[model samples]
Target: MKSLDIMIVDTPYCFAPEKLRKLLKWFFLAYIQTLT
Candidate 1:
């Protein structure tokens, strides 16, 4: 979690609503893939 926070802070563009949404969607997909 700390690493994730640092990552977000480092990537300022993630604050943009559209980019954040896409990032979250991509993260969710990656998480699901790991579960499978």
Candidate 2:
């Protein structure tokens, strides 16, 4: 999770789509909550 945070922060613009990154971040947290 810490690595993921760093990835999100340091990843360059051309490497990933900003909107998808944000959507994935939201879904990742929601999925974790659903598991517990």
Candidate 3:
């Protein structure tokens, strides 16, 4: 949890809404791939 929090904060998109949306889209895609 701590590492995840750190990662999010360290992200260049942390304060950018457009980049954040793209980030979440890719994140979900990666997560779905893992499940498959």
Candidate 4:
């Protein structure tokens, strides 16, 4: 439980929303390109 809490605490630093959104946008474009 403590380890899980630590992981949760650590996650935000690794998964910042701005970075995640940018990556998601790139991935979405790449995925759309593949479908066409």
Candidate 5:
């Protein structure tokens, strides 16, 4: 997660933060569902 944070900071131009955040939120939700 630290690495991902660094990557996000390093590549702000590559992906809009708001969109990336929404995408990450969806992915995290899916991951949680799978875990259960």
Candidate 6:
């Protein structure tokens, strides 16, 4: 779980669709909650 958090934090900038970025950010926040 710690590794997953690190991976998300270490990800590079994205140039994809804006909608996709928003979705990923939401999921990422949920994931971090689990770690806490």
Highest lDDT: give the candidate number.
6
Off by over 4 Å in 6: 1-13
- lDDT score for residue 26 of model 4: 71
Give per-residue CA lDDT, model 4, range 1-36, as digits (tens): 355446445555456688775665675576668679
Residue-by-residue lDDT tens digits, candidate 5, 17-36: 88777776676576568668
Candidate 6's displacement at residue 2, Å, is 9.6
Clashing pairs in 1: none
Which residue window of length 10 is worst by lDDT in model 2?
Answer: 4-13
lDDT tens per residue, model 2, 1-36: 666567556766366688977776786687678679
Model 4 TM-score, 2 decimals: 0.51
In candidate 3, position 30 carries an lDDT of 73
lDDT of all predictions: 0.66, 0.69, 0.66, 0.60, 0.64, 0.72
Model 1, TM vs. native: 0.54
- 19 Cα displacement, candidate 4 (Å): 0.6
CA lDDT, candidate 1, residue 4: 54
Q: Please report the candidate that would top TM-score against the real structure.
A: 6
lDDT of 3 by residue, 1-36 (tens): 356546655776646689676876687577668678
Ranking by lDDT: 6, 2, 1, 3, 5, 4
* lDDT head-to-head 3 vs 5, winner: 3
How would you encode candidate 1's per-residue C-alpha lDDT over 1-36 as one tens digit per residue? Answer: 456556655665546689686886687577668779
**How many residue pairs clash per model?**
0, 0, 0, 0, 0, 0
Report the lDDT of model 1 for residue 10: 67
